[model samples]
Target: MLVKYRGSYEKVAMGLLSFIPDLKDLNNLTNEMTLYQKDESHVLYLWKNKDNDFSGVVGVEVADKYIVVRQISLIPSERGTGNSLEILDELHQLYPDQNMMGSFDTTKLVAKWTEHNRHLNTEV
Candidate 1:
């Protein structure tokens, strides 16, 4: 499940975001969070797994025609478990009318999810 980021989740969000290499630095992480909080176009979400634990974080920039995934990270235990795909799926549900894209860092992850979704739809 995707939980829209709130001020209360700052620590959790930062912790998850730190999993991303580029955001490991405290300064960069703080700036990134500020961008999400200050800019209406950019939004952040926390992923709550089936056990009801927050284990992932995704940041996106919402445009008129598409949502660009800026960053996505999951704890080591959750990596390679298809949870990232699920996070993207929920984002798609939230903005069904818009296409999904990704930033330089997350382009491949978004592409993989898009292809996977396309394959699923074609099979249906």
Candidate 2:
């Protein structure tokens, strides 16, 4: 499940975000996290499975037409576990009335995922 990022989850959020190449710098990671923490327009979520273990992170900017995915990072161990689809699926459910979009790094990922899965009739 995707849970909203909170103060208590700062360390975990930074750890997950560091997996992204662009976010490797501690300063950059801290800055991004601060946006998610204090800005209403920016939102961050942590992916926790049924076992209550966090495996990924998804951050977005709430736009007028859609929610723009600003970043996404999954633990190396959970990279091929189909959790990306799960996280995206839950995000859609959470914002059913809006379009889904993404930032530079996440654009192709989101576009390809939706394109490849659009033909399916069921959720992931």
Cα RMSDs, all models: 0.7, 2.1
| lDDT (0 to 1) per candidate | 0.95, 0.87
Across 34-97, the per-residue lDDT of candidate 1 in tens digits comes to 9999999999999999999999999999999999999999999999999999999999999999
Q: Candidate 2 — which residues are off by over 4 angstroms?
A: 122-124
Clashing pairs in 1: none
Worst 10 residues of 1 by lDDT: 102-111
Task: State candidate 2's TM-score.
Answer: 0.92
lDDT of 2: 0.87
Residue 14 of model 2: what lDDT?
95
Error of 2 at 103 (Å): 1.0
